[model samples]
Target: MTQPIAQPAQSTVPASKVLDRVLVLEMVRVTEAAAIGAAKLIGRGDEKAADAAAVEAMRAALNELYMDGTVVIGEGERDEAPMLFIGEKVGLAPGKGPKIDIALDPLEGTTITAKAGPNALAVLAVAEEGGLLNAPDVYMDKIAVGPGYPDGIIDLDRTVTENVTALAQAKGVAPSDIVACVLDRTRHDDIITELRGLGCGIVLISDGDVAGVIATTNEDTGIDIYVGQGGAPEGVLAAAALRCVGGQFKGRLVFRNDDERARAKKWGITDLNKQYDLTELAKGDCIFAATGVTDGSLLAGVKRKKSGVMTTESVVMRASSGTVRWVRGEHRAKV
Candidate 1:
């Protein structure tokens, strides 16, 4: 006889001067709620609708936190998104709580969720005031690897084969055993061909660059490195995740048009070609949280039961302590 599970409660607020540790699970709630909200829309074949559902839910959850949080990276600019816009302030008592910067993706893989594909996620990154990079929403070229290799083992300036070869040597493994995860797009065809020539294994994802970047950090992922072009906002978010888990990540802004470059300049980016290392992207102590919307590596998808309960899987990380906690929650439907 199985009884209905109790409703999930709030996060554990560990004592700390800064809220990184205390707010770890609070951050998870933001993503978990968004994932749960978006999960209901899965396979509905409406990308925008699903994204909107997630954004609304995430924004509502963040507003309940006890922090003076600003949306540094979010749905879009102030004029673009209704909620969670860049520069928008969240939290119940804005000036009365811990000050922090937030970067988030309400529905990371919108198309994937619409198609019921894998790896869709709801993610958020938090840092003390001025800790996170105020990245504009634009394309960025990125390369990353999990911790344990010497610095400079993989350089973005190098060719794909050269980077893979160097990484294999650093791991002391054969090239064929080194698996790289890259976004599956037409732009990556050349990269794919190059890796194939070098006898490297490649895992291609349709979307969710945040998960794609963090996959390298977990040995279970079997991803030694990740390389490709993705959103700049996501790069900063990924860097924050790596900061908590021990990894090396580098990204450079990629502008497609003069307007894009102009926007970068607006955000105080003086050098278009300057590469940003992990610390440069997310400095000091920070926390990152992500919840899986659909099943994929790194985390599991949200599930619903006949008892009107939903289950969510999430990972929360704090850079100051290098603590990574995986949270599995069962949420009861509101009465």
Candidate 2:
């Protein structure tokens, strides 16, 4: 059984100090809850069921954070999702602590979780109001690399070959030596073809850009760069993670339809294709929490036991001190 961690009382400290404590505990709590929800849907083969469980669990956990946290980018629109919708207020009402903005992916890979595949996770990021971008639910073209590369090494306007060559040159390696991670979707055919032409190795994922972006920061994963179009919400979460690890990421919004374009208008985004730097997605110091729903490079799947279940999470960086923490929790099943 997985058990909830005991939370300390809300502090009357400064906003910075309060954020530090909230980031650590809130992330751990929500991640564990999301893992439990994922575990409950295991073997069900219902993606919506798995996502619903994770969303509900994560929503409840956020309510306990004791801050005036708002869901800047979340599950869906105000009328679309019952919980964690855009502009929804979370955390304690008033007189608590700092007012923050939150962006989350309760179940980053709904299909992956239902299929019990790789790279599925429950991810969330928090920053001060106006710190996190309230991106609409739309596709985003992304290019990312780990720390040490010069700024502007990759941009959305650049061709895949040009970006790959630049990254390879920056790393002092042949183009063939670079490995890029991309979504295994037909839309990425041109990018994939270009990468192949450049002799760069490619790693394909079915879902979960959070894992793809984080993979770039870890040498063992062999994912030198991540280039593809994925959810804008996941892009912000990835930016939060990369911020902690000293990585560089850039994204550009891509709206596929009028509905999506209209949604962008709600956020004051006129140029739907404008590039967004990592800092533009998530600014200042922030905390990012993620727990694997099915298994991934950064964390493991939820472990179910007779009485309860255990879930593991990796926090890329602390908003307060820039420290990373890996947390595991257990919860008992209700009788």
Candidate 3:
């Protein structure tokens, strides 16, 4: 059973105005709730249950906020999940808060959770009206790198080896010094083989490409580059994160058929050959938050303490200030 959401105070303040600086913390709690929900189902061998719990918890947490939020990018279409669908209205409807565009993955890595793999996260990004891209649930060819690199360091049009050579040249290192991350799919066999033959190191991930993309930002992660095809919605979300933090990201949507192309057109995407740069994918004042559902390089997974308390790790970033925060929360049992 689902519960109805209560209306918040009517202050005539728009969500976008308040969200950049004020509501970022509240947004972290939303991802935390979703992570906790999914963490409970970790290693349960039921990916569907884990995803459902996360979607439900995330929806409930979102509805408690004061803003007028729309799920611009979500699980699926209206016929998909009962909630958090694309174009679904969330939060208090018609509230006095600003209108915000939300892109979220309640459970970014369902397969990772079922297998208790690394790099699973609950991630979301919020921007002002028309700030985030209205991307469909389609595959996106993406390439990303962490901060401090010159702009145009990575380009999708270039071959994998050429891109690696460019990055190596920019970093003043040998091609072998670069470490790349790619999804472990047969689709990437040639890409992986070429990268390996170039004397570059490759880290293969089963799922959770969002985390893999973000890893490029952390020098400690040793992921010099991320190149592969992942979700378009996720591509927008990652671009938002890179926008907040310092990084370079570029993505191009991949369509399988006319139906997929039509779906993109339905979302105002007319440029079938468009390659989105960072600013184009996510722009304006934006906030990004991600909480770990399973232990990964970006954040730690939720843990249940022996004393009846639950702990979780989260990272929240604001593009307005280019500030990033790491949060550790402990949940005490309620009577």
Off by over 4 Å in 1: 1-16
Q: After TM-score superposition, what is the CA distance of residue 256 in candidate 3 from its true location, in Å?
A: 0.5
For model 2, how does the per-residue alpha-carbon lDDT over 268-289 read when each residue is reduced to its tens digit? 8887768899888888767888
Report the C-alpha lDDT of model 1 over 102-208, residue by residue, as the tens digit. Answer: 99999999999999999899999888888889999999999999887888787778898888888888878888888999999998889999888888889999999
How much lDDT does candidate 3 score?
A: 0.88
- Give candidate 3's TM-score: 0.94
Task: lDDT for model 2, please.
Answer: 0.80
Ranking of predictions according to lDDT:
3, 1, 2
Return the clash pairs for model 1, or none: none
Query: Candidate 2 vs candidate 3: which has greater TM-score?
Result: 3
